[model samples]
Target: MDFYLTALLQGLCFAGIAFGIYISMKIFNIPDITTDGSYTLGGVVSGAMLTHNLSGYLILPAVLLAGALAGALTGIIHTKLKINALLAGILVMTALYSVNLTILGRSNLPLLNMPNLFTLITFTTNINQNSLIILTGFVLVFTLLIGYLLKTDFGIAMRATGNSEPMIRALGVNTDRMKITGLALANALTALSGYLIVQLQGFADISMGIGIVIVGLGSVIIAETIINWLRITSVWWSLVLVMAGAVIFQFVLAFTLNIGIDANLLKLVTAVFVLLIVGLPRLTGRQA
Candidate 1:
């Protein structure tokens, strides 16, 4: 039970990334590869701040701003410079590797014996319960805030830009700005996940975020599948479902690990699982 509970907490930590993936991929229709690098950037930034005895609350704004800056850089390169969106994300992601290392001044940073957010915000004496409560709160607040944003006029315009750029431009909406803002918002959420998880796991590694977008994408894909099956249309519910999807993905992975799957094989499992999730719908549509 404790193992599964830890997995649930892990899922909650990942809800931010899921939100990011939803904004960039599902909403903006862009493959933002910056997720991998920006995630580590968040961790490194958080880790560095933690070392300085800075309050966890104080460090978050900086982490978020850093992530937003990374995302906006990609957006600028893609929109202003006319580079492919995919390539722009790749470039920023690649550049962030060295930046993260430089910030940490090393390859890894340990938060052992350091005052971190999870402990600072806890309401209970039990470590597990504290983690669960804090992570749950973070995920809930973030999901609601993002869901509300998506339903607003500006957010609707961003969605429209993705759905039909030419149509939105004809309506006098600046599609480029929409894309840039959307990407910035997405990466900010991604950074929040890193900020939270570094404290949760007690260490931040330079390579921790390698291919993390897959985890976020898997959660989004899973939520999308369930939403389509249930025909759910409420924006809030869709966001909630995405959070549920994150939990489910983590639960499944935990089950796999518990069943004796080698840790190194987990990546392969993730790939195959995401592929199946992506492919099954196509197969069903073809049959229909």
Candidate 2:
């Protein structure tokens, strides 16, 4: 029970990344691999600031800005330089490794002694419960905000740019600018996930973002599966399901570990699990 509770908390912490992936992949139809770098960049920025006793208010914006800038750089490469979107993301992600290491000035930074968002306020004496409360609130606010954004005029244009770039462009929409803005928004949320997770886990490492994009991808895939099955059309419900998908993904991992899978093999297990999530539906659909 305790183990699963921790996983649940982790899922909440991951809501940001899930939302980010939904925006990038589902809305813009881009597999922005910059997620891997931006996530760690968020942790690096937050961890660096917290160690210096910075407030969460300051750290949060800094994390978002850093991630957005990284994403925007990728967008510029793809749109302005006419580079392939995937390759542009790969370039930025690769560059961020050295950039993150330079910023941290070390491979790992311990943040246990730092004043984190969870420690700033006390909802109850139980630390885990307090963390759960804060994380839930954080996820709720972002879900509502993103949901609202997706329903707005600009947001519709962004989605239109994704659904039919030529059509949107013909309608006087600046497709290039929309792609840039959308990617920036996606990576900003990804960074927010990093910021929250570092504070939760009590440390930050240069390698923390390695393969992290898969977690978000998996969550989005799970949400996509359900959305298709239910034919969910409401933006708010779709976002809610994405958040739930994040939690469900975590639970599945927790169950796998509980069944005594070796920690070393967890990544392999994760890959296989995601494959099942993605493939099973198609297999069933074919038979049906």
Candidate 3:
């Protein structure tokens, strides 16, 4: 039971990345691989600051800034430099590996005795319950915020840029700027996931972000499947489904481990699971 509960908390910690992927891939139609780098960048930033005795709350804005800058760099490389968007994101992600290493000045940084967000406030004597409450609150706040943003005029414009770039451009909208801002916002949220996860895990590793984008992609894909099935049209509900998808994704992985899958094969299992989730719909459509 405790193991499953921990997975639930981890899913909540990953909600931010799910939201980021939803915005970048679903809304902007950009496969921003910068998420891999920015996520670790967030963890390293948080880890570095906490080691200096900084308040967890105060470190968040820095994490956001770092992630946003990384995203904006990818956007600029893609839009202004005429590079492929995918390649641009890859370049930024690769470069971020060095940047993250430099920031942490080591391969791994532990925060066992350091102050963190979880320690800042106590809701229950049980640490896991306290984490559950705080993580749930964070997820709720982000869901509401993203939902409201998507309903606004600016959000519509951002969506339009992705839906039809030429059309939005003809409408006097700067498509490049929109892409940059959208990617920036997406990576900022991704970084927030790192911020939360590092505190939960009590350490930051240089390799932590390796292949992490798959987690967010898996969650978004799950939500997309539900959206297609329900034909969901509401922004709020879509965001909520995305959050639910994150939780469900984690639970599925937890179940796999509980059923005796080798821990070393977990990544392979994750890949196959996501492939099924993504490919099954298409297979069914063909059969129909």
Candidate 4:
């Protein structure tokens, strides 16, 4: 029960990153690996701010701006400089390592003694439940806002930019701006996930975010499967399913760990899980 609860809390925390990746990868078809760096950047920034007695609310905007700037850099490189999108993201991810380390002044920092958002909520002394409620509230608000945005003209244009870039460009849309805006929004959400996660786990390690993109990718893949099965077209329903997918993926990970897998092998397992997630759909289509 404890393991499952932890998984639930972790999943709720991850809901933001899942949404971020959904927008960047699924919506824009851009594999922005800057997620790996921007995630840790958030943790580093939030951890630093909290250690200095900054209000929890104040740290939120700081992390968002940091993540957005990191993402915007990748976007400008890819769009303005005509660099390969993958290369651009990789470059930023690599650079953010030094940036994060500089901000953190070390490889990692602990937040256990610091005042955080979780401690502010007095509803429940039980840490897990309180964290769950806070994360859920944040996720719900973001989901609604993003879902509503997707129904707007700009949102439709963004999707069109993803679905048919050339056609959208011919339609008098500035595809570069759309891509940059989407990446910025996506990274902002990713940073938010990192910010909350550092608080929840009580520490921010430079390595904490390594390969996290796979986790988000797995969640998105799972969400896509469910979306296809249900033929869910409404933006709201899609957001709900994607968030659910993040929870499901975490549950699966917890189950795997509970079955006695070595802790060091978690990344390997995550990779295999992503492979299966990415491969299974094709296998099914081929069988059909």
Candidate 5:
């Protein structure tokens, strides 16, 4: 029961990345690779701040700000410089590698002793109970906030921009700004997930973000696949699918780990799962 609960909490943590992926892939129609680096960038910044005795409360917003800045820069390069969106994201991701290294001042930062949001919650009594409460709260608040944002006027504009850039531009919506805002918000969510993950796992390694974008993409793909089964077309339904997908993914991973599988094979398993999700539609003779 404890193990299952722990896996559930971890799944909720990864759901934030799924949300980020949805914003980029579905909302903005942008193939963003910056999430891979920006996630670590968030963790590095927050972990470094915490190591310096900074308040954990401040770390959350700080990580979000850092991610947003990184994403905005990517948007600027794409919009102002007329670079391709895919290339722009890659360039920013590449730059973030160095930036993250500088922030951490080395390869990794350990938060084993430093106070974090999780520690504060568990300070009084049962660690497991506090962890569950905090994780649940984080997931609920984030999902609700994202759901609300997607219903706002600006969110509608963003959806319009993604669905049809020319139409949005014709409507005087400032497509470039919408793209920037969407990317910033998306990456901020990704960074927040990373911040939470490091706190949960006890350390933040520089290489921890490797393949993060793929994992996020896989989560989104799996969510869409499942949502398709329900014939659900609403944006809120999509967000729910994202959460469900993350939980399912984590469950599969836990199952594999529990079966005494080699730890090094986890990445291979992730890759295979992604491939299967991506190929499911083709196998079923349906559009993906």
Candidate 6:
């Protein structure tokens, strides 16, 4: 039971990253590779701050701000320099690799002795219970907050910009600004997920985010396929379905591990899972 609970918590953390990817890829129609770096940046900043005795609450906002800035920089390069969006993302991701290493001043940062949000959960007792409750609360709050944001006027503009940038411009909406805002929000959430992972795992390695984008993309694709089968066309429902899919993916991995799978084989498993999900549409002759 305890192991299952822990796995669920970890899944929720991954779900946040998946949600961020969904926003960038689906909502904004942008292949923002900044997630690869922003995720590590979040871990580096949060872990370094915690090592310096910073409050966990303060670190949370700092991580989010760092991610948003990284994303906005990518957007600026794409919009102002007229670079391809994919190329802009690659540029920002490459720059952030160096920036993250500089931030940590090392190849990795360990948070074993630092105070984190999990430690502050109850402030008094029952550490495991408190941590679980606090994490669950965060997941619910973030999910609802994202749903609400997508229903707002600015959110509608963002959707419009993604669907047709020229049409949005014709409607007097600043498409560039919408693109920047959407990317910022997407990376902010990704960084927040990184912060949570560091808190939960007690360490942040520079290479931890190497293939994170693929993982998030896989979750999004799998979720969309399953949700489409259920006829869930609403954006909010789609988000919920994605979250569920992430949790299920983690559970499947955990099950595989429990069955004596080699630890080093997990990445291979992830890659295979992604390939299967990506090819599902062709296999089924259905549009995804």
Model 1 residue 147 CA deviation in Å = 1.1
Query: How many clashing residue pairs are found in candidate 4?
Result: 0
What is candidate 2's lDDT per residue for 133-182, written digit by digit as tens?
A: 99999999999899899899999999999999999999999999999999
lDDT of each: 0.91, 0.92, 0.93, 0.90, 0.86, 0.84
| lDDT tens readout by residue for model 3, 1-288 | 999999999999899899999999999999999999999999999999999998666899999999999999999999999999999999999999999999999999999888788988899999999999999998899889988999999999999998999999999999999999999999999999999999999999999999889899999999998888778899999999999999999998999999999999998998898888878878888321
Candidate 2 collision pairs? none
TM-score of 3: 0.97
lDDT of 5 by residue, 1-288 (tens): 677777888888888788988998888889988999889988898889888888876788899999999889888899899999999999999999999998899897778998888887663487767877898788888898998889999888988898999988998899988888889999999998888899888888899888888668878888988776566778777898898888888877888788888989997987788788778777887763
2 or 6, which is superior by lDDT? 2
Using Cα atoms with residue i matched to residue i, what is each candidate's TM-score against the true structure?
0.96, 0.96, 0.97, 0.95, 0.93, 0.92
How well does model 6 score by local distance difference test? 0.84
Residue range 137-159, candidate 1, lDDT tens digits: 77888887888888999989999
Candidate 1: Cα lDDT at 108: 84
Q: What residue runs in model 6 are displaced by over 4 Å at the alpha carbon? A: 123-129, 278-288
Off by over 4 Å in 3: 283-288
Tens digits of per-residue lDDT, candidate 6, 53-76, equal 987668888998999999899889
Candidate 3: the clashing residue pairs are none
Q: Which stretches of candidate 4 lie over 4 Å from their true place?
A: 275-288
What are the candidates' C-alpha RMSDs? 1.6, 1.5, 1.5, 1.8, 1.9, 2.1
- Displacement of residue 98 (Cα, Å) in model 2 is 1.7
Looking at candidate 6, what is the lDDT of residue 268? 86
Alpha-carbon error at 101 in model 1, in Å? 0.7
The better-scoring model by lDDT among 4 and 5 is 4
